[model samples]
Target: MTLDERAARRRYATVSALFWLPLGLSIAPLVLLLTERGMAMTAVAGFFAAHSLTTAALELPTGGLSDVIGRRNVLAAAGLLNLAALTLLGLGTTPVLLGLGMALMGAARALSSGPAEAWYVDTVHAHAGPDAELRTGLARGATATDAALAVGTLTGGALPWLIGLAPELGARLGEATSGLVLPLSVPLLLGAAVEIAFVSYALSALPEPPRPPTPLRHVLRDVPATVAGGLRLGGRDALVRRVLVSAGAAGSALATAELLTPGRAADLTGAPESGAVLFAALACAGFACAAVGAHLAPLTARRTGGGERAIAASLTTSAAGLLLLGVTTALPGAFALALAAVGYGLVYLGLGATGPNENDLLHRRVSSTGRATALSVQSLALQLTAALTGLIVTVLPPGPLPWSLAGAALLAGALLWARGGSESRPYAIPDATGGPDATAERRPGHGRPLGGRTGARE
Candidate 1:
């Protein structure tokens, strides 16, 4: 790799880590904090639902805004908003205030979704052309992200426990903040501080190619068209559609695991407190597994012949994991817990492996202009499917049924790539100006095995 390519990879990985770290820090304590702040379980669920709805509503528009305005700008805005949201969540007492904070967090999530990855892809492409070894960098970024999450989860979960050990410190903290800053709120406050750092680093470090000066009116005009074009891309391009469907499948599987795991852990441990600890540990393990899988994604692709087959294989592995979870639901004692843990790890591993390969194919099929929007479309599909799957899981009777449903969805997604053909050309959707949208021009030997490490065995 050239010096520029290496630098770009480093920057991308760093930005990814920074962006996700705060989220990880808050993950373990968020629900507990909300409960401590006097929200009933139903209200907590409602707040989360609001968050999901807000994120889903804004995904396309925020993605289009990034594509139209610029990645760094949108990312900086996201960071700032997240900082505010974290502050509110950490200190706010009332449901209204907390709900607003959750909604803002969802907005931040939507705004931040695609810009970082889009920036990396665009940067590396500029530095080393379209056929540059992207899987390595993408995998590194994913690895860094999950690694940050694992670290944050452990640290976040520990902070409250440590504070609890010193009851005087906890009480003093609560008194100083007028009962707003409890021990449980420390992680979120720390996360808010991280957001400040994230914003500063993003603005200073990541650089983007200059886009043509666009007026407010033009931005207003273009975003919708861009979003519409992005929506249409999936319909016209079979490969893109497969990616979207696969995202949905992955989402369903994730929703199933997340919804069921806590209760299962509680049942196994016979106490909610112990189960919470077990779940936190399992969450950390899952993130670590995901990091490992991401680090090995390039090798997985090489062994599997191409990105398509690798995705298929990875999703199949995840499906198997889900089915294993279902089968083990009836098992007794420590052995069942061990198998369940393995199954959980497998699910994340396959998901982590799937991301780089699927996105490699996606970047190959779309131009830089619509790249962020396309990513947002993929994210939207995932979020919507997860929401729907969550609802279904809620209605289904407890047992293995929910797990089976998720496995079936993922298996169907895996089958989408079971049959393969030569890689397709970038679809020529019309730009806002009514001409064919500019695409990354394909060179001779376009779509070789990822990283050019082997022959075109696909």
Candidate 2:
């Protein structure tokens, strides 16, 4: 890789880590705080349910906006809005306030999602290469996000008590705004710093791909047609479609588990009051392990071969973890939770690693305007799946819900990804068979051999 390619990848990775940090940071304490503050648990679930639906509702429009207006602009707006939402969460003690806060957060999330990826891809594409380097940065950044969530959750959970135990570390935090502001304030600060970094990176590192800047008036006229084209093509593009559907199903299951795990653990351990804290810590630990697993993705691929095999293996492991959780009668369920988390993180790596190439393939079938719309359809579908999964969780015994998702992901996901045809590309770090030869060669993922070095060779 050229110096520019390497630098762009690094910049993109940093952006990924920063963007994901807020999601987990907010999630770690959200449930416990909401419930403790007198909101019903079911209502809490409703907040996310609404959140998922609203995000899907907005995904297409925002994605189009990115195409029309430029990703950097949309992303900066997302960051500012995100900070506003987090601040609202800190002050909220009622359902309406909480709901509003969550709604804003959802809006921020929808705005932030695709544009960042698009920006990175466009940047890499402009810099005398293909989409591969961009994808590598994405995966690396995703790993960083996972690690940050792990750190945030662990720290957030323990900080209050630690403050009590050792006053020095948190003395000023307590003095300035008491404990509440400190916990939430930190995430906002990190988010702002990262958001500025993203904007700066966009300005400095990413070269403008030779493509013409889109005109806003023209984009308004064109987006509908572009969206229609993406829908029609995505319907026929079996690989992309399958991946979309699979991600949604897996998302629903993951959502269910995310919603329930802390509650279940809280009940079992008599930590209902502080369950969020413990859950965050444990969840982060599991997520951290998963990030390690993600770092190992290239190595895993070398050993497993390309295609749906490694993904299938991850799903099966998830199923086993789910089953263990369902059947276990005691604290061993903690182990089950860990297993489920491990499975969850790897599944993300397997699937997310595939996302850019899928986009590249879809891009071949459509224009830049159409690319944004196609991405939107995928996002819309995933959100729909998550909302539906809410209904499933409302009924299923919590433990069984995770198992159900695991089984569906393994059995159904495999069938879906494999439905299109045999992969013509080498199932390696950068799967390039689906796009043009030049694009494939420029792809820059580090290999993750099963039980071997990753990026270490670099």
Candidate 3:
């Protein structure tokens, strides 16, 4: 059955919430549970590395699978994988089992990266046509996702502490469960249960047009070809490339902040325990600010005249925030601390605003056939850049240098889009009439279009 624009947006928001809440629940407890199970800090880091590598490896392949097979199926598979991963992580004592669980979790993350958003865009286009308003719905979905995350984080952290208050009851429960159920394990186990609901809801709510059946061999062949096409999209489309590079820049900024914030907090508070608490509070605040920014994305676009300009403005704001953080690092006292908090919130807010606008522009350029793959390519760019930036930030001498480096990267990204929204033109794409449609004229010497004659409009 076809869905109207409103119904599509509602379902997208719901799916996004369901998909991310479980992750937020686990974020507070996963590392603690691992260390509690006798793994050292180095081993815990290794497990995290495993997760990252697995996710990076599978991102494009799973994305192409969604493009070829369908969104609903891939999303269901992701939920199922996450369920198993969470279960194993919660109860397993052996390092092998824990590592495998982390790997599976990463695989689930890769599979889930693009299908929900792709489905939302496809459904809206199916009902409302290509030019339908998407930024509002996309903004709503992002807001829901961040809201769920913030709520889940608070609940997750509270559960274990609340359980700790009644030591006898906690001991009794642990004894009854044969050492398998601990207070720290509660969040992961709860997340596993949420996955069941997520899978069921996705199956019932996310209807799609039927895809033609294909042989297994054909499926394998098409996936790689689609991934290659997705990679080539960046080379041919300048705006898409800008989106990708900007994502990397954002990733760099994010990595720098995440890597440095805890130590800085500890320095201010004079204790790691107090710093962890402060960081947790800051995380929740960051998520809340992100939700607010997402809610304002459509209005930002309207005021700025287009998505491209909105992105430029948002990134510039974020760069300014980072620079503020760098400047505050040199100052001392509670006033500097307050300023740093504002800068931190600004970073998340600007990044949140950038997301919906960037994706709106991206969706308008690519067809449904490669939509998920294109998103996967964008995610891969972010992940790879963040990982690299994490290493680079560590090696640099501590203080404002790292923050300055990240700010410069973000500013460069903003500059790429400073050419104004008038230059924001749709490139050539295959139209219903089976010929290239030059929806907008191409500027001179901006580079040639792919698979089209030279001097042709793109």
Maximum-lDDT candidate: 1
User: Model 2 over residues 1-458: C-alpha lDDT tens digits?
Assistant: 22354666676666666666666666555665677567888998888766766787778777766666666677777777676676667656678877887788888878876776666555555564433323245456556767777776665555545555766665677477655554434544444455565556545554444446667677786555555555665566555566576667656656655666667667655677666555665577666755765555444444456334455554444444545554442445467546545544444444444443334344433344444555667777767776677667767754554555545654566555443223444222111112232123212222222132223332
Off-target runs (Cα >4 Å) in candidate 2 are 1-3, 32-50, 91-98, 128-135, 164-216, 267-278, 329-369, 398-402, 418-421, 425-458
Q: Cα deviation of 153 in candidate 1 (Å)?
A: 1.3
TM-score of 3: 0.93
Q: Which stretches of candidate 1 lie over 4 Å from their true place?
A: 1-3, 424-445, 450-458
The per-prediction tally of clashing pairs is 0, 11, 0
Q: Which tens-of-lDDT digit does each residue in 1-458 have in candidate 1?
A: 22377788788899999988999999999999999988999999999988999999999999999989999999999999999999999999999999999999999999998999999988888877767767777888899999999999999999999999999999999888788898989999999999999999999898877679999999999999889888887877777889999999999999999989998888878899999889999999999999988888888878876677788899999998998899888988899899999999999999999998888878877877788999999999999999899889989988889999999999999899876444543333323222355543565445546455322111
For model 2 the TM-score comes to 0.77
| Candidates sorted by TM-score, best first | 1, 3, 2
TM-score of each model, paired residue for residue: 0.95, 0.77, 0.93
Global CA lDDT computed for model 3: 0.85
CA shift of 80, model 3, Å: 0.7
Worst 10 residues of 2 by lDDT: 429-438
Q: Which scores greater on TM-score, model 1 or model 3?
A: 1
lDDT for position 326 in model 3:
84
Candidate 1 overall Cα lDDT vs. reference?
0.87
Report, for every candidate in turn, its global Cα lDDT versus the true structure.
Answer: 0.87, 0.57, 0.85
Show model 3 residue runs off by greater than 4 Å.
422-426, 430-458
